[model samples]
Target: MGVVLAGGAGSRVGGADKGLLPLNGRPLVEHVVARLRPQCDRLLIVANRGLDDYADHAPAVHDETEGHAGPLAGLVAAFGFLACNRQALPRWLLTVPVDCPDPPRDLALRLHAALAADATACCAFARRTGKPQPLFAMYRVDDDPVEWRASARDALHEHGSAWRWHAALEAIGVGFDAPGDAFHNLNTPSDVDEYERAHAAS
Candidate 1:
């Protein structure tokens, strides 16, 4: 299973919905979907707003909790959905933020390979510039998803949106400098413009 995290306050982006921002004349979510869809057997969209627009690209899903929680809330939503739909429970879940328009093509495969190689690893996450990208990661779904719900719930309660997902999952984060541009995200209107200009030059 693959999930796109489009639920965010976009605080740095002047409240603009990052996923809906246009890139190369298409929505940023469209670019993300093109990057991830080929790598997963199933795909889902997690967003707090713009459901109708996102639904046009994939099955739109929303967070279970209110207040536009964060990436953790999106995970809770994905896990809860998996719990209700038992058929996908056995599959691992790959997550990427919708703002990331240029994620690596083999992201899912790389994370899966990493997890398979390290049995003790609960999950595998990617990093760039020596910083962990928690939302760009994958997790094993062999266990009950209710545990994830509880984890997010506890984090939200104790931390009040200050909790980072890498801490929540105790993730085995991996950092690499992939060739060219990867992990480029659209967080601001200027970012969108920058991406367009750079991509056009390329």
Candidate 2:
């Protein structure tokens, strides 16, 4: 399944909901969903607020547990939801932050191939600068359910950073080639400005 992490509080953007933020006249989440729809049989949206607004766009909506635990919380909730519904879980989950509009089109296919290349590997996308984009990654979900949930809880209680999620799973890095820099995310008003300039130029 493909999950869009739209539950963030967007504090970096002065409390604005980055997913709802408009980019080129459409909600950021809309762009993300459109990009990922072709890659998955089902779409699950993980949002903390305004989930109803996206109901028409995403097939289902899920929220994090109380205390604003963050993206890992969303993932855990998604896993539980799938388990409860008895849905056929995909081998890997393609996760993308709602704010990132131009994620690689072949993300799901590439990550699947990359993981298959190595027996013990998770795959994450990286910028040319070599910074790992944790949110834009595929995680192995079929292996150990107990350990995955425990690690998620620990990350929530301790720091709410998904870095632990990366550490728990053996991850490999995939890089985006040049001219695809439009994948830059909008975290603030200035970022929106930059996106506008760059998108308009394209």
Candidate 3:
């Protein structure tokens, strides 16, 4: 399963929904869905607002946790939705933030390989230049959905950082030898403009 976290407050971008922000003549979420759709058997979007608009692209879910808690809240919501609907659960979940319009094409392949390499690792995320991109990650879901749900709740209440939650899962960072802007995420209008300029140049 692939989940796009579009339920953020977008505080950095003046509270505007980053996913709906225009980028290169299309909404940022459109680019993200385009990149992620091919990588998963099923794709879902988690958005607090614009549910109707997002639904046009893919099925959308709202964060179960209140106050737009974070990506973990989105994960919890997705877990619940899958539990109630799917006859069988997916083995893993690949998550990416809507702000990151251009995740690597081989994201699932590399992160899945990382978890396979480590028998005990429950999560794996993208790493570039030694920086962990926790949002672009693959989490072990087949092992114990209940356990992961509890862990996500604990993380949401105790420490809301995705990086910290993945750490608790004994996550591994899969290195990607890609350009510096490979994981670039739009946080502000300037970032949007910069990415658009780069995209046009490319």
* The best candidate in terms of TM-score: 3
Candidate 1 vs candidate 3: which has greater TM-score?
3
TM-score computed on alpha carbons, candidate 2: 0.87
Q: Taking the tens digit of each residue's C-alpha lDDT, what string does model 1 give over 13-63?
A: 778788987789999999999989899888899998999999999898888
Q: How high is the lDDT of residue 60 in model 3? A: 94
**Which consecutive 10 residues in model 2 have the weakest lDDT in total?**
122-131
Q: What local distance difference test score does each model get?
A: 0.82, 0.75, 0.87
Estimate, for each residue in 9-39, the C-alpha lDDT of model 2 and write its tens digit.
7888888778888888988888999999999
Candidates in descending lDDT order: 3, 1, 2
TM-score on alpha carbons, each prediction:
0.91, 0.87, 0.95
Q: Tell me which residue pairs clash in candidate 2.
A: 122-170
Estimate the overall C-alpha local distance difference test score of candidate 3. Answer: 0.87
| Candidate 3 positional error at 144, Å | 3.0
After superposition, which runs of candidate 1 have C-alpha atoms over 4 Å from their true positions? 160-165
Evaluation by lDDT, superior candidate among 1 and 2: 1
